[model samples]
Target: MFDIARQHLKTPRDLLRFAMSRFTEAGLFFGHGTDNAWDEAAYLIAHTLHLPIDRFDALLDARLLPSELNDALDILERRVSERVPAAYLTREAWLAGHDFYIDERVIVPRSFIAELLPDGLSPWIEHPELVHRALDLCTGSGCLAILLADAYPDAEVDAVDLSTDALDVATLNIERYGLEQRVTPIESDLWAGVAGNRYDLIVSNPPYVDAESVAALPDEYLKEPELALGSGEDGLDATRAILEQATHFLNPFGVLVVEIGHNRDVLEALYPALTFTWLDTSGGDGFVFLLTREDLVTGGL
Candidate 1:
């Protein structure tokens, strides 16, 4: 198998095609930063060669030197043999066109909430300019926190996570973006460490995968930290904690947005009376909901 892969893999495009074929045959999952084998292969090949991923079309036919080809083959072999997500293998992940360093220490940033940040949480947030404070709970890579900062330039953002290693990665990214003054990384289990601190907008892409779902996830997902995926039986343990305390931390008229993924049904059943305004994204139903302080306090549907 290895001999066959190496024989036909001559140019960067050839290697990418071979990698994509192997990836498809292995039934690899592509939730982290990519949605298909072709894109993932292109990302690995482009980044490995230190070429621009966006400019891959022009460089696809470019042949790699012997040493570079060897490096590419080694990475592809590990990707298949180890069943690791391409992001972990490459040590980088992109969200909203911005790159962030990643490793086993943190979950690869792939939050759907990122797609909604540009509109300034419109309709839900009547006055975007009034959003002075924001919070990002379970901020695995601080991607959302950084996006929050970019979306709300005047807002001071606080990103919280329980994993020290994840926080380290987040800290690096915060500094990389030169957002040290605007974004603060906090090591906390949910909102524990940041209690009493309130925010006008609180966003989270928490651990919402149920035990069974976690167990059934592809090997690629298993490569990520379990703490960043599994929550509880209903996949709402962390989410419940956030909802229970989010009200207290949200200022008047403040809104809380969360991504529950496929666990939306369970969340609705758990809190049937509360009306959840599911947000729409380009990819369709984002499974993210918005709730205002008044909605939480008044139990208004």
Candidate 2:
């Protein structure tokens, strides 16, 4: 019993480490994402100590109380047994290298846009300097909205989302990133709230997952809000809405960079008569496309 207790309390640099010896007994126990079972355990333990994961190493030198250990295991057990996202359990997520508060109030942070933000998306934007006005549509967690503000320090950004719940999360992210002034968190349904407003860039990681795809996603995805994941069966309803309204809201030199994920082929097929540039990356091809206002008006897309 002493060995078991000590093992569960072991930490790399003095932080608590819970054993995974009992996780399998709790569920279908497929070990689907079990390689990081220790990570899940640490997350729960770290939270109880009011320390971030990075701080755990230094803070672990202090001893954990019995109650903290017991409470952590209880949360970790629930996570493994239920296949709930650790972010949902922790009420936070890290995106674009920043930590943001989150909850069931919003979807977990996941976006191809994050890949493009860090390096200025050199290949996609010819004149990144000209990106003065930008918009982050369906800004669920406001992750993209905040990232853009940080990337374009000189530019003011707008974050629009239909859900007040999501906007609330976005609000926290905006405030956390100190982008409250630069990034406006608006509760608007797509273009409705920004009527007649034109931007140099409109970026969106919208709800493009079709019903079938959403249903097929990993159990971790089951924890997110359905509104943030699903589009119509074809998955183009939201895309079409954005594309149709985007051109009217873009400057002559502006471009709409949107992420379609695996539905790129479907989009390409639907627009068989037109053309789009799909971005290639080390991981895989993204469904991101840069559409210009002139191209939309000229049917040159």
Model 2 regions more than 4 Å off: 1-38, 50-63, 118-120, 123-128, 217-219, 298-301
**Global lDDT scores for all candidate models:** 0.87, 0.74
Model 1 residue-pair collision total: 0
Task: Tell me, by TM-score, which candidate is best.
Answer: 1
- lDDT for each residue of candidate 2 in 56-160, tens digit (9 for 90 to 100): 666666666776665665666667667777777777777667778878878878776777773646644555576788999999989888888777777799999
Q: Which tens-of-lDDT digit does each residue in 1-301 have in candidate 1?
A: 7567666677988887788889889888788877899988888888788898778899888777878888888888888889888888888888988889889999989887998885837887766578899999999888999999998888999999999999999999999999999999999998889988989999999998999998899888888899999998988999889888878899997999999888777888888778788888666664788899888877633
Q: How do all models score by TM-score?
A: 0.95, 0.83
Which residues of candidate 1, in runs, are more than 4 Å off?
3-8
Q: What is the alpha-carbon lDDT for the whole of candidate 2?
A: 0.74
